[model samples]
Target: MNFRDYLLPADSPRIAAARGVTPAEYAQRMLATEKAQNLQREWQTLLDEAFRGITTHGKPQPDLFHLQDEGFDNTCAVNAARALLATLSDEHHQRVCQPVDAQQWRAWYNPEIPFNDFGVRLEQTSVATREAFRRLLRSCTSPSGFEKINHLMDANHFLGELYDLTNIMNRWSFHFMIFGEPSETRPWGWNIYGHHVAFCCFIIGRQLVISPTFMGVEPNIIDRGNEHDAILFTEEERRGLTLMQALTPVQQQRATVYTLMEDPAMPPERFNFADQRHLAGAFQDNRIIPCEGICAAEMSPVQRQLLLDTVAAFIHILPEGPRQARMAQVLRYLDQTWWCWIGSCGDDDVFYYRIQSPVILLEFDHHSGMWLTNEAPARFHIHTIMRTPNGNDYGQALLQAFQQYTEAE
Candidate 1:
């Protein structure tokens, strides 16, 4: 909520000190002093204005997509979102969903953000409704994609056990929300968000853009003997290493910015001091990151494949059709992309790598302690994100393009 309601009077000592005013004889200061900055009004204003344009009702399609062609087919996903909405009561519908243009679209936070008041918490919802929501998740993402999300949740629960926190930190504490009406012809999106995980999937006709995705965890492994080899972020870690090894000395020299990752004393070129470990992380939707590391065109054929494969590890999370469409875009921009790295290229070294292109930006980093006790950044702590820079995240760009195309036609 807006904090304006709790604002102190203008004449308050703290306010006077901040404004460099001596609170002259309780005079005109009263006018400005009494106006305590509160957020309750502004908060509601944002809520009411969030999704004012998107239609309240929508239908299947209006020639915005050609699912039969080389693009995407979102019929299943569209139906699933509609099905989930049908299962909800009017109260739940109002609470759990947002309009396509809602500001809540940008309100998502990974574990990095402490705000907990947004989105629909699945565990807090009725059982029948929760089950129906999962069905939508299943329909939108592949089985493997859904599995990875659940694993992240369970890892959050595991962390809670170590930290002695409440059930709010449990595996099922994830939040869900839909933006825009579920219509085949219209552009809309949904988000599944919570600690250590935030998936922003947007749909514009037959195209999908899943970006500003945040995936990370503490104690990145499940130590339970029951589920042996329960690990996450390994493919990302391994593929990044594979690409680094495939690079020649000259290429590595261009890509490797620093041997000691995140060292404050390191030169500005060696590390991004602002983000510390990961750039384009949470709350960084508008970060301007110039190309770093070596371009894919500079790599050997094998190294290029490794780079593309590493990218696939993130894009593969999309359903088959959308994944293929997005992968095609990655290939189209292969020459323009940069593959940069920090930290060690040694066999067992904690490191960071970023892949950025005109259409995509992916970051993988081994971070130091936040939830864990590790002082040095380790393989056990991982953070990875896939973003579409240049304001295309959430398919907003594509939606605009589609609108223009139809208007011109």
Candidate 2:
């Protein structure tokens, strides 16, 4: 469907209502809605489950992740972190830094407005500090990974321009915070989140884990003819659809968990206003999402390779070393992996699909518009999540392993 057909005029009631209000005021107004309040209550209930972490069944599978030296550039990452810290004054430093295991790591939410204001909002920071954080990002991610992330930030700015809402969705609207001290031999991390982007990276020695990552876009492009123009998720969408089409008719039938994006037969919890068809989005740290759809063990060699390629599209976000390590873990657990789909896989259709295994949980969903006015899920609006399940999200499992090793020593 053409998203332009769904665009809300600047003077439309919704757009007009949000205009001129500060982002905080808009957040308060949005959060005060009965629907938003209900979501918050439900999320808090999930948060109280003690964070055993994401699992297929109720219990976490043990030894799914182990600490090993992967040759990550931890020294460079630490140096970048120190540079960022050096740019901050004492007061700003205190606010932007936290312990490695800080609870605020789980508090990141993906919306334009300030949600709790827990870190240094890039828009409010000096240029030097923002550049330092960019260097930190470059240090931790592959070159392509870094570009994709900055592309999302630029897309956010374009959205703000689309609605004349720079107060809320500008490129620098995100929050950047460091966790733990800059140490090559100890665990530490960083978080950057705003609008449709959120990334939490945890590092321990030469091992690195970047999970509980959320990247999405509305309209999926910044085509106003400028340096920031981008069209996202093309490969991610194409690869998944190709895999689905490659399956046998029977396999396709089994892999399709639902026949429609908003299937009436789904349980009430299957879809929500904020997360749509994604069960692992913000605040779902310990959700017990049972495996659905066809197993990879059921695939032929050709189709199986297609499946791996599909997953690699999302896994490419990691630096080369960490990407290799993560893919190895995924390959090791191939027999236990599941691939599931919602809605048709037609070229023009909007849909959602997931790849889940003991070591990973990846979700990509087409969503109904929020800022624009589309009332149905559209290909142009997308949300994708990557999580290391069975207790590895936010690298909590790795952190626990580090603690155990330290105690034993």
Candidate 3:
């Protein structure tokens, strides 16, 4: 489908309303709206809840994650982090660094203008600082992962160009922050977040945990006939569709949670304006989302491989070593995993699917337009969330284990 046809006019309410305002001003106005305020309150309540972590049920299963060293050296990443910190002024450095367990790590949000403005915003940074941050991103992620982030950011800029809203959606509009100090012997990592993207990484020695990541886009491509032209999410979108098609008719029937994206039969809590079909977005650190589809044990070997391939689209954000470690973790829980879908699996259909296990929770959703004015879910507007369920997100469990071992020693 051509996304260009769905673009809103320059004078449309969504575009015109924010034309003269700065990103922060626009954020203030949006946050004051009833819907935004209500969501803020709900987020506050979720955060206030005791953090047992995201779970398939009420309680987290024990000993699923440990503090074993995975032999993945991140010395280069640590050096890059130091480089970025070195480029910052003392006042900026203070704003850019936080304790490993600081609450800001969990405060990430996926909006064009997020209300949580506690990090070093790239747009406001000097050229040297931005370059240093880029080097750090390169060090921390796989090559393709870094490229995907570039494309997502560029797509944000392209969308801004489409509606003349660059003030709020520029390519460099992301916020970056370092958590704890950069160290080889200690645990620390970084978080970068903004419109349609949020990634949290926590590391201890040779082990790296990158979870609670959110990546998405509207119109998913930059088609200006230049070097910047790019597409996003094709692998993820196609893999999800392929897996759904590979299921036998009976298996598909069992896996389909609802035949419609917004089914009347679904409970009220199943969908909402901010998150739509996603149950584990920002501030949902401790949500109890029960499994709702066919278990992985029911799949044939080939079908199971397809499921893993689909998961790899999300997990590939990690470097090769950490990706392998994560895949091994997911594989260990295969029998207990569940795959579920909402909406039809027909080719070209907009839909949502989730893969949940004791160790991982992934949700991919095609959402109704927020700026372009589509009243129904569309392929052009997609949202995907990856979380480490059962107390491992942000590597909190692993960090706890490491701390205990070191303290005892």
Candidate 4:
């Protein structure tokens, strides 16, 4: 029999009573609820099992990766579950589920700012999510391991953010539906939906390029603006501003932010001081240099090289003309200060440079294209980072870079 044939009817009074709705409404609600609940339960079960395996072993198991594809499926499943819950009368599911309070709803819905404002403590929650994801990571033994499961947890986290944002936007939409006539608020609601869709695509697509196995920087949401003005800035912006404000006057004018990953064994001071003066000279010559405050952390040299090569190749393969010029301009900006560098004790350093000013109040993913063979084709894999002009407190580097350029004359 077809699945629908065996499905329970929605018009049943019993189901309605249990759901605190009329018999007709209950029947329809149950049909959707039952299916959604079933899927949710199954996915949760798989996730739980995966988590158990990882915690018990303290290392990822091979089977865990197999379940990574479920990340997308689980997102759909959760959405369905949320919709099913919405159909039920609030009276029925008061214990297990409650409609988000105004404060909670606000926190959940607003994506323009960081999660802290909403009281969603990521560090604490991630401990649990990370453990669950650990199991999923252990399962990958194939070449596709990174490609398949590496970013599932990050994607899942993003989905959670999306869910909250959508819920908030939906609340606004409902208000319009009730009051009658769409207005500016209504457009805002639609924009939220569009934003969420775009973000979802970005998060999912980015996973394929820099999965957990690759050891590259993970994307993070540093700052999200208020609902009325939702904007996202890059991590580059977050760190750059601080560093810029700390630079000397001469350095400030000529300085730009560059992100470099050096061997952990190499002292950060060594990398920063040793390279700063020389790089500043290069910048005077219109050459790109490392940013101040070099961040040296543990990362695989091979992974670093792959990222750099991909970016370099991206620069080399662009079509000639206006597009190329624009790309070049962005490249020069990125190259001047934005650097993703990796090094090992014995291996050569690998670096990726960009001249494009990092987008502020927006997220850009580099992983989506039909050309699978193209370098850096994995667009969305790079985590969200931001760049902005130095504010009063943190823009000295911008001044330094500029001053250095002037002194060169």
Q: Write the per-residue lDDT of candidate 4 for residues 146-246, one digit (tens) a residue.
A: 23222332332342343232222221111000011112111001001111111100111101111001111112221224332211222323333333334
TM-score of each: 0.79, 0.97, 0.97, 0.21
**Candidate 3 minimal-lDDT segment of 10 residues:** 43-52
Off by over 4 Å in 1: 1-73, 112-116, 164-166, 227-229, 265-275
Q: What ranking emerges by lDDT with the best candidate at the front?
A: 2, 3, 1, 4
Off by over 4 Å in 4: 1-326, 332-409
The lDDT for every candidate, in the order shown, is 0.70, 0.88, 0.88, 0.24
lDDT of 1 by residue, 89-152 (tens): 7877887788886667666656522343566676667777677777777766767888887788
Sequence-dependent TM-score of model 4: 0.21
RMSD of 2: 1.3
Q: How badly does each model clash, as a count of residue pairs?
A: 8, 0, 0, 55
Candidate 3 per-residue lDDT over residues 1-409, each given as its tens digit? 6777777876677777678897788988888888888888887777766667998768999999987767667898899999989899888898999999887888888888566778878888889998998898888788899998888888888888888888889888888899989999899989889999888988888889988899999977779999878878888999989999999999999999999999999899999888899999989998899999899999999999999999999988888888898999999999999999999988989889999999999999999988767889998889999999999888888878888898999
Candidate 1 local distance difference test against the native: 0.70
Q: Candidate 2 has what TM-score?
A: 0.97
